[model samples]
Target: MASPARPEQNRVVGIALRLCAATCFSFMAASIKLGYRHGVSTPELGFYRFAFGLPPLILWIAWSRNWTAWRTARPLAHVRRAVIGLSTMLMGFSALAYLPLAESTTIGFAAPLFAVALSALVLKEPVGIHRWSAVAIGFAGVLIVMRPAGSQLPALGLALATGAAFGVGIVTITIRQIGRTEGTQTTVLWFTCLSVLALGTLLPVYGRAHDATTWAILFALGTAGGLGQLFLTSSLRYAPVSVVVPFDYFQLLWAVLLGWLIFADHAPATTWAGAAVIIASGLYTLYREHKLGRDRPKADAPL
Candidate 1:
């Protein structure tokens, strides 16, 4: 692949893959939601996702012969990411089962907002005022979604989504820490290895064995998850983060549509209303970042 042509091809591929990732992620949300009703524990469900997904990854590694990337200095960072990543995955699965997909995914999208705050704290980066306001509005949106005083919302599911968002946010932050020194593939590979090991240990003791249908859903969960991450990562090769990053929010639309058309999960009026706030606020933050430009330190500056 020549340099100029490679970039052009990558852009086309990136868009296609991201669209695919969005679809896969939405389907995964639906699958995990359905799987939970079959009495499958989160840990066990994880094992199925990772274990089934492992062979393809293994084959990719063998073909590429990039074994040394796994031994980077930040292996421990990868471990931390995996732990948080696993929690995020499990909580998401749990939320899907208990809450409407629209609500579950809408709340889960809060991770990016958390990412903004985490970048400032852990990265010691400067945040402009506009982004700060976005963070505030996004949280308010979250509160609206939760509707704490009202009984109509599913409290447990919302809590799970919050936990998942935080976990994923931490994972994202930690990735920034480690990814600077390590290849993304190395980081992701170790994450999968650590997560599978962690969950495998937990499953035997506490996980309930699932039926065939449950297993199928679990496989879909793993496949969709792996593919989504792959697409998202591949997308960076095409455009700058500023251009491609915001496209991530498109997942919300996919989730809402999938919930209604596939899983029969519908968002409450409040959920949609709050989502608008979150989106509006989040976009403001991105716009701030864009204005700040290349010279401005990223949300995660070096500690």
Candidate 2:
């Protein structure tokens, strides 16, 4: 058995891994936006992202000699996860094309809120007042950021981003349900493989020729995405959900920085304020879940 202090050390390491995952995900978003700027279509980008990402995951499985992870009794569950997850990726990358990175990222933060409601409606999970209250507060933050009446972001962009968040919430619930029987590698493997096959089929219709820089950007997107998944999986293995989840909010900061530096995009005061509210609500919700002894492993970054 491990020493009592061992868990504490794991928590520390998990926090670090979560932070790294956050950065990798932010970089993935930036790379997606960069790829779009170079004339890559969303479908093509999605195909490359998943296809290129597979090698790392495959190598890891081989290193661990966990070839059994490839075998699954839950093929339908994986197919369901893959379909929804691929839709989430397409919508999210599309949103990045139309919205500033910070704004799109802030909006994506609402996934946890959506997950809370879905838990009750779909999973028949009982949610207490505290979690419900947090959900409400988080949506309020979303409204503040959206300011639908006077918002400058294109309506389609907002719709896609919100849709992506909704898709993520569904993915989260599916993950929790299937997590009972699937190893982390199995889940990740199936999702990536299915996404690649699904998206790759559409490439001929949507794909465009890429220059050297664009090819590099696509490769970077895949690398960052694959590494991000790995880091997030490792983090959860090392620590409890409550301990490392809050670190995910750090992606907003990374998004802001990357947006400003790469795109010269600066979010207004309202966006920042709304992000703060969302972050606070999410942290509080996680805290409440922990207190209620209902904490569960959460999906990692949106990427």
Candidate 3:
């Protein structure tokens, strides 16, 4: 088991991790966006993305030649993480298929909003009124972007994306709890193990490959996504999930830009407005956390 990082370095490391993860997720989202036009279903794309990427990860793990950290005290928990992760990817991609990329990206940003609530309940973390209020405001923005009341959208897309967020919160808290006993690399390796194995179950549906150009895009997606996971794991060593959570909304900015360039969709007024509200609320949450710290904590210091 890995020890907790010194509290002084937590926030610094966490922000770096969040920044990298945001980029990786944005890259992956872009790839998924491309795949959408190519007629690649989410499941098929995910299978290819993970499968092609695994051999290198495996070789790297084997080259390190130490299985000690790779072992987890709670194997079943890893299984659960894998399942939830698969659910998250599946739901997010499914949303991508139907919704405009920016809208899907914006709604998925609600994962942090979900995390605020879940962390309080499941992890028993102390979240002050300001954070709670931020959560409420964030949800209001989500409602505006989703406009669930205005139309009969696909219930499954909304439900699955939200459920995926709930699952993301669970995975996050689980990683935190387990971190008390696990090294960052060990934690990452184990989760990757479980994720690959679980995602493998969909092999039967893994469809035919597209042209070589599409293959290149998927490969880049896997590489960037893997690097993103690495940065995130390292950042968690220094910081609390709460500190890094909000930056994830940054992905929507990339999504919107990519949607415009690739799909030729002009940003609607509501999409941009809802995005501004969400980003504002998230910034407010970060401000409160930073201000309350009084003494500025190390970027890598965990809360």
Candidate 4:
């Protein structure tokens, strides 16, 4: 039998891990933007990012010696996830090129709200009124962030970022469905492999890295992305979704700090206000889902 305090300890560690994941992902976004500034196109940056990440993932697999994990009964399912995942990466990186990091990160908070809507419309999953209300409020928050009338950010950038969030939501759904029969390693490995292949094809037209420093940055970008994903996946293994999901909000803090420190970019007051609304709505939706017994660990797929 386990001690009473064991669960609490796990929850604490899980929250810490989740926070670490958030920080790593924030830095990854910053690196992507940095790479863009150095003339790396989105496709090239994304390809190298996944390509460099392969070594670490391969090493982890070798260490675990789970060769069977590499074999999956549902190859097509993995391909589907990879396609959606690639779309998410393209939209996300493209958004980073056009928008400030903090704003892009804040807009990403809409992912869970999108998940709620997608679940209802596509999955035919039951969502109660409270969750629906939260979703509506969350979209309103997005509009506030957009502030179309006087917004300085390009409309295309906002659309791309929002689309990225929705793409993440779709990925989340696929992850949940695929997770029923697949392990984390399988899902991640397949996605990385597929993304590399898909993104690699565009290298002939868009790829360019002229210096050692640029090459190093591209490698670091991929490493950070891979490690951040590992950290997020590990966190859920230790604690329930309800315990660590909220800590994902920490990404906003890291984003704000990184944007200010690295790029001297500051989000306007409106962005912060909208972020608060989105955060509240996301938390409440999670709460309502948990309360209604509709929440599951699979629902905590990383954005």
Model 4 TM-score is: 0.93
Whole-model lDDT per candidate:
0.71, 0.87, 0.67, 0.84
lDDT value, candidate 4, whole model: 0.84
Top-down TM-score ranking? 2, 4, 1, 3
Q: Arrange candidates by lDDT, descending.
A: 2, 4, 1, 3
What is the C-alpha lDDT profile of model 1 across 1-303, one tens digit per residue?
A: 111222453556656656776777777777777777777777776777777666656654555566664667766677777767777777777777678877776777677789889989989878767777788889999888888885476778888889888777777777777767776667767877887788788876977756787778888877877666666655666655566666666778887887788777677889889888887886777677677774221221100
Give the per-residue Cα lDDT of candidate 2 at 127: 88
Stretches off by above 4 angstroms in model 4 are: 1-9, 299-303
Candidate 4 lDDT tens digits, 145-226: 9888888999999999999999999998889789899877788888888888988899999887468878888888888787
Error of 2 at 197 (Å): 0.8
TM-score of each: 0.87, 0.95, 0.79, 0.93
lDDT digits (tens) for residues 271-295 of candidate 3: 7777788777777766776676622
In the predicted model 1, the residue pairs found to clash are none
Candidate 2, 1-303: lDDT as tens digits: 211222344788999999999999999999999998999998988988887788888876776667687789989989988878888889999999999999899999999899999999999999888889999999999988887878898889989999999999988898888888986778888888888889878987998888899999999999989888888977876899899999998999999999999999999998999999999999998898899897666654435
- Model 2 TM: 0.95
